[model samples]
Target: MLVFSDLEDQSGIWEETKDLFASDFLYHHKLTEYNDEIYLDALDDIQEHVWNCGGGKITQYGLPPSRDGEKTSNVIRREKSYNKESLQKNVNEKMSLLNDKQRHCYDVVMSRIKNGCIFNSNGIFLNAPGGTGKSFVLNMLLDSVRSQGKIALAVASSGIAATALHGGRTAHNMFKIPLMEYNEIRTCGIKKNSELARLLQMTSLIVWDEVVMANKNTLTALDITLRDILGNNKFMGGIVFVCAGDF
Candidate 1:
């Protein structure tokens, strides 16, 4: 994966076979497990290409056939996948389960999502000990946002923690952050025109679990990438970034 960070250092054979880079990466890492949404966009592109080559017209299932169709489809698919009624019910039921401390954290995060912070913090750091129901509160927050027809991303520093949340993925895979730190320009691999970028742009909230397990450069890279992709100067491109972990 580090080879993706430096084009100049790559060998001549790698440069000639650069078109297979994505396929190689996917084949080796099995990214499809957690990265289905982005891969769906790629499938759309492939189908479109085959249709054009075979002189067949592109058909739309739920998405348009325009240039940005895949991006729109991915966003709409994610938005519609949530059962609003069930999510709202879950949120309501879960709210009562939150203890005083957890309830306060929930309220603070939801409020930040509703009302922008004056200092542009747009970040909520929850420091708690183990067995404090941090995951419970995080799920409630995710449900609360999704219930309102908004997009909330659940990601974690590690895959084990990711499975604890609803529709969670590893933060590195979700953001396309390089596995190994390269140079100082620390930036994620999300192209501005890709569906993944569109997803991030539409994201209202992001819950990152076990955040302390991640390297600082990972977060820095995400910050820089989000600012560029979302075209916002605020922290995390003004997205509600929630970091929860046992410290």
Candidate 2:
């Protein structure tokens, strides 16, 4: 039969048991003798419990049955604490600089980060006639994320507009996107190079400005090329894609 004492003492016991399970076969044999069925049952139960508690699982062998529950609980607590710390760090870093709207947008973007959405792919349609401070908002967002030690790449369809963003450059120059116009199959020959591929893989954020100017066909090609180059075009280094354009 299995037994648990007071919740607090049980929790403390688990912490110590977790270490024993890390190594030492004596505990493993003891577990087998105590209740093999419960032992196997606990593995799945603990995994689910930990996950529900916002903790991930780690596997280990040669542990006693008495230690399993405590070990799992401790691991779950530790993971939860660690994630809390990371989130606090990110928030504290951004708190001072972001204003209201920017803070809202930043929160939305950061959700992807917390949810493990790695392919920083997002389309921001800034539809407020020309000169509505859209550019200002974009710049602020970029600076905020960069200040948190993330790389932000800004690319625009036009050279002049790209320069206006201060730190931004032409999409062609930044991503090396082919200049082939839509419907012209062989206009821009495909190049088999790894430099741009590597950059895409490592880059955290890709801000494509003036996306409205990009032809549908060109956009399709760019998407396909990026998807091909990056094994998973979902999220790049926890980077977010913020596209600011006038439509």
Candidate 3:
């Protein structure tokens, strides 16, 4: 009766030891009419089991395997798991060295996320030249939000450029934008009630680099697709977009 979603939660220990964690969640909780106390207690037990499976508390689980057997890269995008403690440790080390300007930018964006005003703010753009540390700033922001258990997407116009970002994928690959030459209007490759659409709805932040390389059609396509998926007409379907590039 127990079921755990590999699609939404981060993959790693959670997936490896899902069998061990499921007995309680899929069976006991249902039998008890979905008791919170029981669920929390089970989580405690499951956490201990997960720790023991990894050779006790001292061992590290490390990163996930990079086997893209299906080439369904969405699995990685939808389930980006990071070592929260280790990620925080790394981000802190990086944050300490930021220049005053970088620090200011980080603080402002972090403030928006923390204050929960991101949706209200509409969007953000880290307008800077190549040497101005735009990528560093963006990485810090992504790490900050991710550490707080929020989803942040990283995309770029080019595959090579996307590699430098966290969970970064080409915007076309991730969004599934159509490549039609004769089309007057455009729509994304996302289908209704599909996994990509679900992920888009759940995403809290999107950081797209190399925006200048994309055309107005691409942006319009994204907006139209989002409107379709999110059922709204507002810009970017009311999601906060952080589009950047050398403009």
Candidate 4:
């Protein structure tokens, strides 16, 4: 049996060889043991085979043992075959279309998705001067997310603006925002409406446009309602909130 005077000295080689075996020939045989001498002897055998065949020097590392008890020569063939197939598969699925900026945004969004969208900030404020393409950017992002099979909802202070963004009425109409009755204070219970409740629960992205025009009291009320329904599970609503407005 091949042995090593100090196993730790060759630990790196052993790990690399193990990964090679798993990726290249895992189904062929089970690796019962690992020894430095055995690995080195396998390499020498490969070199000898190449020499006998009158080929150039065949330098390689981490050869897998054969399932049929053949020499290490078979291991190299298996690795070549496996690697070629995996490479082709990867190339075939590569992305076809995405501008640089869009790709960057997509990567950021994907990272957030992997981490589960419970962003630290209570909200994200995207600000720009009027007609600075803020709305254009928002619409592009919305389209990208939707293309990925996500649902995005757009709401604005004005019905016309909201309709322009989402192809429908304002968030008030979509979310059923009622006119708050003065003095009653509690009479305007927009949060209690089942429709708004469902939207809040299921929306993956909430784009509140023209936030500057939103009344202070109504904004406060909306925040309170969100806190009550969403609780402390910041991302529980299935949507990340993004507010865009001009100062």
Give the candidate number with the greatest lDDT: 1
Q: What's model 4's overall lDDT?
A: 0.50
| Winner on lDDT (3 vs 4) | 3
Model 3 TM-score, all chains together: 0.65
2 or 4, greater by lDDT: 2
Go through the candidates in order and give the clash count of each.
Answer: 0, 6, 2, 1
- True lDDT of residue 96, candidate 3: 84
Residue pairs in steric clash, candidate 4? 204-239
Per-residue lDDT value at 4 in model 1: 20
When sorted by lDDT, best at the front, the candidate numbers are 1, 3, 2, 4
What are the lDDT scores of the predictions, listed in order?
0.72, 0.52, 0.67, 0.50
Find the 10 residues in a row with the least total lDDT in model 2: 74-83
Give every collision pair in model 3: 1-26, 2-26
lDDT of 2 by residue, 1-247 (tens): 0122124344445456643433222231223343434344444445545545554442322223433444333222221221234434554674666567656766665554445454334544554457656576666555545555555567788988886563577877665556554577322233435434555555566677787887766555666666666655543323456677777
lDDT of 1 by residue, 1-247 (tens): 1212333432453335434533532432224542544344444444455344542322332122434432234333544456678789878776777789888888888888888655458988888887888888898998899889889999999999998888778998788887664455389988999778888888999999999898888898899999999989898999999998875
Q: Residue-wise lDDT of candidate 3 within 46-72, one digit each (tens)?
A: 444444444222122332322222223
lDDT of 4 by residue, 87-165 (tens): 3343234433444654554455444544553545435567768866666556555554444545556678896677556
- Worst lDDT window (10 residues) for model 1? 55-64
Which scores higher on lDDT, 2 or 3? 3
